[model samples]
Target chain A: MTKTRTMLAAFAVGLLTSTAALAGDVRIMWYSDGVEGEVLKDLMDRFMKDNPDIKVVIDNVSFSVVREQLPVQLEAGDGPDIARLANLKALSKHWLDLRPLVAEPAYWDKNFGDQADWMRPDGSNQISGFMTQVTLTGGFANKTLFDQAGVALPGKDATWDDWAKASKQVAESQQIPFPMALDRSGHRLTAPDLSFGANYIGADGKPAPLDDGAKGFISKFIGWIEDGTMSKDIWVSAAGSTYRAGADDFINGQVAFYYSGSWQVPNFSTKIGSNFDWVATGSPCGPANCTGMPGGAGLVAIKYTKNPKDVAKVMDYLASEPIVKEFSERTLFLPAHKGVIEKGLNFKTDDAQAKAALGIFVTASTGLSDIARKLPGWAWSDTVYGALVTRVSQAAAGEMTLDEAYSRIDADIAAKVKDSAL
Target chain B: MAEISRQTSQRRIGQSLGETAMVPVSLAMGLIDAPLRWVQKTFGLGGMAAFFLLPNMLIFGIFVLLPFFINFAYSMTGGTALFLSDRTFVGVDQYARLFDCANYLNPNTCAEDTFWTAVSNTGWFVILQVTLMIGFSLVTALILNRELMARSFWRAVFFFPVLLSPVVVGLIWKWILQRQGLLNFGLFGFGFEPHVWLNDRNWAFAATVGVSIWAHMGFYTLIILAGLQAIPKDLYEAAEMDGTRAMRVFTRITLPLLMPNLLVVIVLVLIRAVQIFDEVYVLTGGGPGTSTLFVTQYIYETGFAAQLRNPGLAAAASILMGLVLVVLTLVQLGLSRSRDKKGARK
Candidate 1:
């Protein structure tokens, strides 16, 4: 018995010693739309090879999981050391201020510029992280369908009604089932919503959603749905702020016009090759202005991580000019790094359509309204967006009248803001 | 006579094998009893039971009871903060928010209309899903219990869908029911218009209920089948000997004998229907303007799905849902007990 006990104790001690020998591990919670996750993994592999004392684990999670699970995990003090997050304003408090820890703070300020401020709460000049890809929400059309239908493509300054009429004509002529579809995201909808002169953020810096401009846009949107210019499938098919992508419908050549964003450029470039001619255009006009929303996902280091220095190291490497350039060129993302953007991305795409689409989106980014730029960085932007989409969707589905929806949007946004108390 | 003697010999052999197998088991029990007996002597029978149950009790208390109490505490707080320290104690504000309606029946006049919509949808879903689920299960159980060819194979086939994950079941049905899906294709082939199954409000709600029944009918059928087997053969035999009809026999014998199991199925299906999330969520996502949204989906969305996670509001909604479930379970149990007494008296 004594001999057996000694053997067990020795085995346990050896197990503990073996476990202690391995280096400290850092987990990066990541999600990808295309190839960015793979690009980051490749970069991290190089980091691991050089710095063998630190191990990095890339937890490839879904976008929904990142949105729904990451905040809960962060609040519980058990989030990953680094994570790719889109809802930066919502999770601003939990971000580790990388300015103090990064290798060269000036490099971030120079390249990222005002982009880093989007991840900071309340417009404070604290640097949190750099943008993975600068995204501009806009519209794309099946130009082939338009040509076949002999319906002329609406120009840059065309009104929303003009685009709708053109798209409907194209669909009718070609027998396309869905004339228009938009990504069922509240953020995506804001491009058009803001064009109707709806100032989502009031002068007092609160979400006041029910201004006359907003009501006019929502009422027009409801009219479009009723008239079948926009399919209810993408808008009213899901409930209560649930996001549904219409990329498949667009790619399948079943939809004549799809309103999504620049983030879809790579996907459409790859998937719709030699199938249908698609084009990304500037935002269609409303009464106020023709502009799209400027938004992007960020890779922020979490505050509660045990290895802040290691995380900073990874961030610095990723934010390096060469790495950022290569990542943007390969992933077909607009470079957030000012130097990379100025140096001109040798955007390695042979597809003329993709190149043209990129040019249009880049131009559109410049023409975005000041409100669009500020909306993404606002603290309660999500609350404002969520309230608008949920109530407006209900109205579109005929569950409530337009007046009731506007009132509800106002009440819901107010309640949500008060409830959060941020 | 030869068969009977062979069976008697086989029974003796089985008894001998059973005794052989129990030797080590009995020895192990004897070894365990020494400490147990000492404990009992020192304390009492209650102490012995308590000692035996300590591990399970600790597990339940720490995991189940702890979370439940935490949820109760969370329901009293407010804010999008996930941690209790970050939350503000709002007392009954969350509950009040949920119950703030102009008319109890009209969800349209409510402050938090989504919650009421979910409740109304769930109420309709339960009424429809439970009734149809029970009826179909009973019918399937009766058919399977017959002296049909390949009965076991048919039984297995009926229970096959139950083995699949809820997500899988939902996806399979979704693929069949989508706009360009097999059902539409087949309908087009048959000279019919392709109807949108999941995109239409009423159709989406119906599809959710129908797919739920298809996925879960097998489980309840298995239960009812077991109960059908437990019914006495002699009662059916005597009924067959009489001039009683098939309908009368089924009504008198099979249904009455199956009441206890039927009650179990009803209560179980009721609780499960109220807790329905995974299947309907995957199938419809409570869509076409919240027509198929259930209370559980509402709670989940409030707490997690949204960018602003309102755990306090979600917790309050969940507690109210729990109260509803508790009331349903009590009513079901009372009905079951009363029926059992009536059966005993008979």
Candidate 2:
């Protein structure tokens, strides 16, 4: 009888201690583009050493999980304590407001204030999250390929046509498959669209129809695919708005010019590594303006977290000026923190090309169009983007006419809007 | 005399130990025996059968029937919400939207053009895949059933793909088909121009059909081979004795005997062809402009993968696909019943 009593007592104690331990646990769902996962893990280890009572666990996952699965998890009111998300504006309602929970609301406001609206509900002063990096959609040129082909890289004020023509020349001379290849992503496409003076927003603050500016660029894009000036493999390889990057083709020297984004800096720095020379060309000029879309992934606290206080602590530590500066430097990500940006970062990389590319992206960030600036916080941006990618790819594949694709884009966005209506 | 006595003593001890081990089992039976007896007395033997089936029925209801009902409910609602409680009831509006087409023939006229395009693609895929799958599987099975050298090795070679995961099958074929892949290298070596096989619409569609057939034909071949082996060998012997031609003998004896298996294979192949997604999705990603897009992938992307998902629309599309599968299943059941009835008559 005494032995049984002791066993039951031990079990009860174990359960109580485990529950207490779990109460302090903070889980973060993270996805990385480059070596950021490792950088963050190192920082997290240091954080745990300092705050032993508050356990921080990082769940490393693919970008697809963050894009596709995390939204579903959030919708079901079940997810990690925090998540690093790219579609921050669309899922803003599910985020925890750290204004009350954080140690100093003014600190957060002064540091992350500029981009806070991009990850919170409209008309709310909620300090929801902070952008881990500031990304701008742009172009990268394979300098080695151009050099091998005896073709000079286009000038700074070069138009999309000039770049396309020059890249095609280099591709032909080098006997490579793709002259130019843009990532099969809506965000990537929008840089060129905005440069062509495409306005995605209307007077009602809803998605506008595909205007002449958008059509002009898209029609040209489709023609390039048809004429083999652009890589058809990237665009038509998938259907229905599925994202595919042409970085591999570019890295492999098959593509002369690749249009992706600033986020590919570290990825190319790590993967391309002296195999070939590359340089960021920023976005090419259009009839309207030379511009690129402004966007990035943000780390946000989920409202459904049981350990809100612990989550706030972790967020506070990660959002500190010194920590953000260190993270940006080590990961080679462009910092979004105002203080960190003002202080300027010495990006920790030996790759001259990567350093130059980072400098180019920072310069490109200043030339962003007004529409591009607003798009990151716009609720209907993703809706428009999804429609553009789906229909434009179809047109490129000769499945439909460019005019039909434009019509379909409008209809698809309208349907999405209606479907989202309460 | 002492050894025999010792052996008898050992045998007695073993028996005693066996009985002692059964004590717990006997006690367990005794504990439940009374309740079981009472249940049988109150409800009769028919109810006892149902009582025994209760656990499986409960599982089926919770996992299968419950989700199915919830899915049907989702079909009747509209919203971007993942949970049913948060969604608004739209009462078949989602289905109406799917059917809201200016012209049924051209997907361009449909409100949901991608869905219609997928349906058309799936239809073509089913016809080509089912016909070719049966023809190839039947031929392979016949070849394997013959008295050939390394017969077991040949069977294993044919059955290898069936054991592979669909994703592995897709990746293997993709490596061979992509630009700069082995096929292109071989073509270049042979002084022929290398073509991008997966980038062209016609080639992409054909690849999806061909790859799916390759991945799945092995399983069907094994089934047909089993049916082939089950045939009475003496029938072939008698045909030879009568100086019957090979073709005539096969048409008369082999095909007649294989009819039941063939019917089963046809139904199975047809059903599977309609439900195809994973291997094809990985292979073509429903592209070179939605040319390889199928019904299952359409439902998946609409519900889950899209930037702003419409679960209601996806659920409606799924319910429609389910109805098509239901009709296919009924046909299979009818064919199976007729086959059973013919056996009964015989």
Candidate 3:
């Protein structure tokens, strides 16, 4: 009886040891805006099933956690094997170059050719990550309000003034509180800034101080806030570089015109639910062109990963055409995959408004200026963004004049750039 | 004889129940007793006490003192890197940047304008908040000290906000003061136009201060209340026998006796008011163009929240703040000592 019991114990110990040896844990620090986390989980499950030796753990967190906390973890060399990051330029050094481990480098190069620069170090051709979703900034309007107020919606080449005039008329007629409301995000303001001919990148490809066009955009925005065309509560009420979304106002039909990005489409469609008719419009033209900011988040492998091959395998599976297509379709994201974009995703949304908005934003992305495409890659973009938000918001809040705001923005960015050498 | 038997059986049951409870405790003690006995035999009682305390001391040193030292070291360095090796040692440069103002009194003339703006805002906030908090807390404590209907219930009601999370308190106040919120609704019913309470800079600051006072006045009141309860009733009775007027008795007896407690409250409230962040952060976000910004907010933004995570600059700012706090604490201790000496003399 003792010998038999000893044999049973040995068998149990052996089973546990073998299982532990076989299993390799790959933790992916993830943050989500919508249903993408669920989609990624499903994809990861399939990958794990095929490669039974590997296990993937998704550490789901908030956007702010990803932005603030993950960097500290990475700097300490205790970050996850993989992470989903938005500020790619800021975290480019800590990203693992999966060039050698990837099954086929050609596939990654072809699929993520333009986005590779964003994930890699300056002037390096390495596959650090892939864009999960390519986002563009634009605006949506309350079509029902426009119709009721007898104001015609502007055409594709319509200028900022045209939209402003139309929105103001509609707001006055319908007694809407905010004629126009914008999210208090510097990134959100990029569309109008670029449209107004902001030269964020100088001739030398360095981040230039706010040009006349950028100042023009700020001036117009401040003018709107002063004249009651735009609401101060959304922009001026909050201080510093704090982000404030106007989704509530837009959904409640309080805002006739809401300026945000393509990311808000899925949210608006689901949350609004036929409350009012809202439609995505072309980015209003400024002195330069009708343009928008091209930006997105990347799913990256960390440099400190012990299991490079396993991480690569997971990335390969997630970046496969079928998986990415399904992810983009389900999440209603504009696909970063060239093949998926070319084929055109069948967005799995029943809402007509969402479908139309997605179509409009995708087309708008094609017309993004060279400067706009390159702005996301610049190391100093975040510095520029911070200065822009702080100074511009202060000006909008009536704390300082526009000139003081402009001078402060220039000084702040200059000081930051000098201190940023690491 | 039946009652005696019943009592004897109950005693046996109680004994068995206690034994049952002690079984696990005895086993745990037995497990550790051997090691403890060995330690005491090997190193004596003094060493044993130290050995027992070593784990907690090590934890505190590692978690608290180590980080504080590192922060101090980082304050003397410059650069954007999180690690020390990657950072450049620019001794006192960050400090210079912070203090390099043409006119320190006017934040607009300062090199680091935002820091000075925060200082200006925080100075006003600390002065107003501490004064008001102490005054209201004292008044409420005096009121609650008197015999009244539902005194305990009123005490609980006043102390309820103190029990609430700062975030919850901020959210509640924000909801009440928003443009389309309860306050505005009441104003509308009164045939008055709705005021943009949070949008205006002055109004936003005033609102945050008001909410802060309401939320925290209860804690100070509770402290004073305890102090009031501890005061000897004989003193009040003597004052009454002397035919002292109510106001004079309060001034001569209650105020003098409550001085120590009041000082404690003042110092604690001042420190708290200086360190205010979460409540004001959630309420105003230091907004309406930095009119409500505080030093803590500046440190937070410079350290972690900003696009440029300049820990060096943040550490410098924090060290300066620490020096100020240390000086204030020393002053508070001096005053407390003096008060104690006076009481002893009396």
Judged by DockQ, which candidate is best? 2
Q: Residue by residue across B1-346, what tens digits does model 3's lDDT show? A: 9999999999999999999999999999999999999999999999999998999999999998898889989999887888888899999899999999999998777878999999889889999999889999999999999998999999999999999999999899888988888999999999999987888888999987899999999999999998899899999899889889999988888888888898899889988888889988888888887888899999988888888788999999888887777787898999999999999999
Candidate 1 stretches with Cα past 4 Å from truth are A1-23, B1-20, B46-54
Evaluate candidate 1 and give its CAPRI docking class based on DockQ: medium
* Top TM-score model: 1
The 0-to-1 C-alpha lDDT of every candidate, in the order given, reads 0.88, 0.93, 0.88
DockQ of each: 0.68, 0.81, 0.65
Q: Which residue pairs of candidate 3 clash?
A: none
- Going through the candidates in the order shown, the clash numbers are 0, 0, 0
The number of clashing residue pairs in model 1 is 0
Ranking by DockQ: 2, 1, 3
Which portions of model 3 miss their true places by more than 4 Å?
A1-23, B1-64
lDDT of 1 by residue, B1-346 (tens): 9999999999999999999999999999999889888999998988989998999999999998898889999999998888888889999999999999999799988988999999999999999999999999999999999999999999999899999999998889888988888999999999999998887888889999899898989999999999999999999999999978999999999998899999999999999999999988888788878888899999999998876778999999999998899999999989988997997898
Candidate 2 per-residue C-alpha lDDT over B1-346 given as tens digits, one digit per residue, 9 for 90 to 100: 9999999999999999999999999999999999999999999999999999999999999998898889999999998999999999999899999999999899989989899999999999999999999999999999999999999999998888989999998888889999988899999999999998998889988999899888889899998998999999999999999999999988999888998899889999998999999988788899888999999999999999998899999999999998898899898889889888998999
Residue A164 miss distance in model 3 (angstroms) = 1.1
